[model samples]
Target chain A: MSCIPQTDLTKNRIEEISSSLAEPAWLSKERRLAWEKYIATDVPDPKADEWRTINLNSLDLSKLKTTKLNPNLGSFETALPDGGKLPKEMSAALKQYKEIAGFIWQTEKGTQHVYLDPDLQKKGVILLPLSLAVNSHAGLAEKYLTKTRKFSHDNKFSLLTEALFNSGIFVYIPKSVEIEKPFLLGFDFVGNTCEEAVFSRLLLIAERNSKANIVNVLLSSNAKNINASPSLSLVSQLNELYVEAGAKLSYAELQDFGQHVFYNSRLNNYVHKDAHVDNLSVAIGAAQSKVDVATYLQEQGANSEVLGVVFGTANECFSYNTIQEHNAPDTQSDINFRVALKDQSKSMYQGIIRVDKKAQKTEAFQSNKNLLLSNGAKADSIPKLEILADDVKCSHGATVGPVDPEQLFYLMSRGLSQKEAEEFVVLGFFNKVLAQFPVPHTLEWLQGIIGETLCTQFQSQAELKAEAAVLVK
Target chain B: MTKTILTIKDLHVSVEDKEILKGVNLTINAGEIHALMGRNGSGKSTLSYTLMGHPRYKVTKGQILFHGKDLLVMPADERARLGMYLAFQYPVAIPGVSVSNFLRAAVKAKRGQDVPIKEFRAELKDNMTKLGIANEFLSRYVNDGFSGGEKKRLEILQMALLKPEMAVLDETDSGLDIDALKTVAEGINSLASSDNAVLLITHYQRLLNYITPQFVHVMHNGEVIKSGDSKLAHELEAKGYDWITQELVAQA
Candidate 1:
């Protein structure tokens, strides 16, 4: 056990966390192995190609202490229909949170609550806390938990999450069952203090011939002045999705946290034969965020479509790495991720489509488009393909450019202000992919988030000009 | 006598530092339909764009006045809100912004308040039906993927919706077929009234046959070289631009 100062991430503390959760012997052993891997693997090398743009040294892992569980941890009060007593900022965010999520499971301030729709429960769907699911669905959990069998975790962050996660949810859809309404799961790491780290996980299993839709929203609540502190809060999450043969799953995720938060999340989906998966993700908030999304087509006749939208303003930094891997014959994958950058913000996208030797007749497509709205704004887009099969069809493309001046002048000629003109053009640029979401309301919600970001960006400039005009007056 | 709606005094406009409109002058009063006809490079489009306050067309040597207010100093959108409209020769496509939303926003900006939704929808439907435009266009992105005739009709539709005090139609009739030209001409004719005026910039006299202009002007070398009744458009269409240029050279 290596001693690490300023953080409770030592071996003893990790093992104690496992014991405190009252996990089964197998799970405890699993955590111990993950801890061993965490200690063995060093922090990511900044010079590595994937980590070149990101400043890994700035994140002081030692200062990010593990969250202390409060004995009086109560249910998620703000999630109720009639809002219970919560802080002003939390309650305000929850009002919007309630509208998108039908079934809510939120972990905040070291407390976790699980809510399942009664109609869904009657239909034999199971949504439970991860702790309870270990005993109730022991066979299922044991088989699939930490099931990144072929893709080993060479990164220290994944190992750290596996070793330290204490709060999570398990969602299971039975065979041939279809839920009309999508499920919503929220993981919030909130704190008033300066130093805290929250680790959470999600494991979703869709059985054969079943269909499900889920929306996961990751958020954080922190004091406005917390940015002044050298170390504020760290939110780390991992989600694994398993879609069986002849099944379909639509998953959408949104990462919206405060400026005082650094969010790290990974989403991995495995699709079997004749199954379909649609994944959409939107990243708009956070001081710094790194997200990895991977979809593996594990059998013949599988298809996966992934779409992502990211908007960055001010000094926010976001990176998205995606992979579409075809392991079997007759698989198809398509991916498109668009980013709009304004102010002095920066963004980068790395996408890969891999087809193995045996994966003949495979078709894959990927693209990343970026719009830089300001001179100081920067963006990097890289699209790669690894094709071992001569009979496969694969293509990738990327583009980085400023907003079209002609388009802006066109809108301005129609009596729209410059800001409104830019917002309209940007929204149109993203709608090519946003309109593809399976859930209709999700498109509207994503548009609202993009709209708010643009409004803040241009409104501040307008206010500054107005103040200057007043001073001259 | 009617009041002058717009007056340009020796307007010299340049794009990329190359002078496109040099010392051009024109005037239009309320209740008048005037057509400015010229050859391809005769500065007709440049004059319209400069009058509409397009930033690319720098008014280096002259002034444009709308209702006695200097229009050159105003931005493009400010010119639009001040009852000046330009039907572009090439309408710009704003993808993902619905036609209905665009019109509503334009109406709001012109009126300085949001038009009630019900009222706006009713107005859009009424105007669309009148112009032979289907209701489906209201849901589509503005000018995106529309055919030549469709873009022209949409321009006229916007002019009708905005009801500007003065409109500069820049080659709105160039790419339209005979049937579409008549339909668009009727749309323009419907919008024309005693309270507003129209300045038509076109290379052909086909549109003038549908909507008769009370006055016609010939443009050469970025200036209006001749002004007469509608017969001047007919004379130009009959003899082509060479006949006029030959006469000008002979006289010089």
Candidate 2:
């Protein structure tokens, strides 16, 4: 672990990533400027909300590399209908990584893909790699580069992401054009053997009357296999999902990383008046992960839905930070998050709904529910509301407890075993959060995964109650 | 010895520091039905609960023996599995669990093994029909949004499925209409067996009209004051609790 020396990220790596596609010089300069912004912004120093009552000194980010896009060495193959059906176009976009308006890391073996519908290309849509966006579409890229993401936040991981940042795509849907299919990018992160780390960045600009769905998935395979052969992969992606007077945008990120690496991600959005944005982030599995997602509602009827779901178990740690900003009058935002914990796993949910004075009639709601099924498992939810608008309705609540005993006993008495009874109670506990996001199949998948984890980390009441009494008393 | 299944000797119990039963004693043998009738708060339901060993009900200077073994020594679940069942007067509703699943668990707990799916469904359907329960009720949550009569029917339906050696029907006829009363009484009558006994706790003598009891006992302030044949129930119903109280006062 101590044999490797620290390396500094310079303009060369950024240029190489852009020049690999022979991207014009202007885009390369913009990449350099974005890297400079990465330098200027400090890493985040988590406040009480992020790490309350928890210790996280084991996260060290000093010795890591800014890696190149070494796509996974394999053709896409999967019966799973999601992103597997279109391998031909995906591979075409994969090789032209630097040429596309938006560049993203694919989940399959360092697979990287881009989105460029020929029709939109004919309409002069400046969608390509972030480097190209900076060089070729400098005016638009600079104005929106770090507009949504907070890279300057005080944190070592943020600083590392900024320092080593290189990959990710840039997308801009020109005025009055519609792209029906979702834009997807997968990143496979394996830090060890390759000695290369990833800090992928994305910039998305949807002009007035433009419609699109950008779906990016972050993944890591254990290929760079050796332990602390450590390549730090941090992705600071920006989604300036502009919904001009009449535009619509849907952005989603799925983080399913290798069970042995650290994943640091930050995503944010800025929506304009009369525009709509929906952000859905699902984090199913990860070794150690931190996600920051927020949306700024800038004008009247500028609505946003910020939804997140996470699963944490065994030694996994999940920290989530969400900020919903209502910056315009009649603007609305809804934020909901649910976490399931088992074994020694831990998850912290800290979210705030802020309503500025000018943002009157802003109705904001925040809720966090945690299901703790093990003696060693722990969950903390810190919900906050800062309202400067006297006319706004803002409220937040958090709940942490074991399943209801009476409810469990009642079910057990009917014919269900003790385990079956508890499963029902736990499912009922998060029914409210599930209602906000009407995706039942995803909810069922999450429920099954949690139930299996509960089976392993479970101890009967005799074992847990006695242990709890001794500790609390 | 006529195979006495339940033998209560001076059973005194209290719940949460309040005395419910004071020196109550009763005995019933298999192949016979015993009816314990009393007014409200006479400890009729309390005796049934204490017999099942509810954790909150502490037995004070008493012994509840079923088939010559102490009932107070076992947990509620074990008591249930040991062939003793209670048909709750007001069934407790458990949300988010289907009726079929709940009944299956109770049966398994009593039988101590997983029942085969085919046989389980056939028996469950038969019991539901016997209790006048609709097939759709099996899919809904346990007693959630069920009517008063439906809850009572479900309780008795459980009694039929568990087939306990002895059953304590606590006011199972309280909230039933004429049709429901007839249906529930018929269901109970159909389950009667020479190998099992029934302890019917009620506030009315009307239910006994359809399903006759071999013996009847009058409970006053936790003790059985009078015991007689089925005609005793008719005589009490003809008059009222006041008639017996007045007679006792005259005798004293």
Off by over 4 Å in 1: A1-5, A69-80, A83-102, A110-112, A222-225, A468-473
lDDT of each: 0.80, 0.68
Question: Which candidate's DockQ is highest?
Answer: 1
Candidate 2 wrong stretches, greater than 4 Å: A1-4, A7-47, A65-68, A71-109, A112-263, A267-289, A302-318, A335-347, A370-379, A459-473, B1-252
Whole-model lDDT, model 1: 0.80
Docking class of 1: medium
Relative to the true structure, candidate 1 reaches a TM of: 0.94
lDDT string for model 2 (B56-109, tens) is 678997788888998787766667778888788777776545678678778887
Model 2 Cα displacement at A446 (Å)? 2.7
Candidate 2's DockQ is 0.23
